[model samples]
Target: MAAHNHIPLPIGQVPSSPYYIHPSDMNSMQFVSNKFKDEGFTDWKRSMTISLSTKNKLGFVTGIINKPNLQYASYKQWERCNDMIISWIMYNLDAMIARSVLYFNIAAEIWKDLEDRYDSIDAFFTKMKMLWDELHLQSYSKDFQTTTRSEANAVLDEAQ
Candidate 1:
């Protein structure tokens, strides 16, 4: 029989409290339009850069609704984040459908009519190949009342 030595993992790699992440947080939740004089466009851009550059998937758009700042944020800012997040989710669904070679092990080709990424994450999803179906496309609409608090929370928990 051979004796073995067990090595311990580092604390940093142990996955402690990284940061409060909300999917909406990455969508520039506190961002006002470039027109808004007081708007923190810098924060918006910085957040977007951080989101895109992050190695963590949770750091992306999905973190928008997940991350909540203790400091007060305006309704406009929250609205902006919500709008961007919903749109991003729509685009993501569309892209996955578009880029998918197949679904559920079924023989299906969904990526037949979409383009490629233009500039950002939303752009990438928008650019993916997808067949235009007025009916099914409705499912991908932001108006769709599908996403819920628990649902998003579950996703966040799983990712974390």
Candidate 2:
């Protein structure tokens, strides 16, 4: 009987390493089912993060795995991972939003830009909600109600 020996590989060669690209991983792959529109940035981000983390590629966008210097041997591996991450992000984004970050070279930079842009959107929505609530509260209610469409139209005609 022959005994099999298992050899341990370096982190770079391990499947769990961010630098290690699985044969199945491709640039055209869509990580999330729902494409991110201009709104719902928070939910979109969460979905993307989960998908990336599952692939063991979360560090590329999170900036935890820093890219090596251009001259370094590992630089190419890092760049490939970064590009793949960017592709996944772009695939899940709306066309307009994707174009806005298309020129970005680094995955982390794209992530940061998206975060900054969406934060402003969140603030705008917050302000609009507050205004809506205030307006709703200030609106007056009448005791008499018009039950039919014609009655409502008559009331509107009277106002005119």
Candidate 3:
């Protein structure tokens, strides 16, 4: 056989590798200070994504680095990394939200559930805007007084 060109670095040694779990990466480590509180999912997701990316563990939740089979040598390491990622995710979630997903064993599954349940800010804003437009349309009647540009300017000056 030809010489092997690739040699796997020892565990926790390859900072760039997805499977490399840093010694400081504990299950109790909180990736972000703000917990996801069933709202502001976009901001919460962005913060967690940046933190996980920095640790090279984003793939765990993104489903890029899948869990290996039990017979594989890296299976145990994968479990450790997956569990750690799950714990980090759980820690960043609000108590109720975390408990909702507590039974999920896969990091990706928990991420998907959270995304499905709460990641709809864009749609929510769109719906709110539509409702506001509808309300504005409905609130206007022929009986209402219409202010001209000068009248609006006068009102602004008075407020100032």
Question: Evaluated with lDDT, which candidate comes out highest?
Answer: 3
- lDDT per residue for candidate 3 within 1-160, as digits (tens), equals 8987898676646787788887777887777778988677888899999999998999999999898999987788889889999999999998999999999999999999988877776457656667557546745865224646585456445433
Q: Which candidate would rank higher by TM-score, 1 or 2? A: 2
**Colliding pairs, model 2:** none
Which stretches in model 3 have alpha-carbon errors above 4 Å? 1-8, 129-160
Model 2: lowest-lDDT 10 consecutive positions:
138-147
- Tens digit per residue, CA lDDT, model 2, 31-70: 7778988888878888889989889988888889888899
> What is the C-alpha local distance difference test score of each model?
0.35, 0.81, 0.82
* Candidate 1: tens digits of C-alpha lDDT, residues 18-119: 232344344323322222121333443445345433423223243432433546443334334334433333333334442442231111111111112222
* TM-score versus the correct structure, for each prediction: 0.19, 0.74, 0.74
Q: Which model, 1 or 3, shows the larger lDDT?
A: 3
| Cα deviation of 79, candidate 3, in Å | 0.5
Total backbone collisions for each predicted model: 17, 0, 0
Task: Give the higher-lDDT candidate: 1 or 2.
Answer: 2
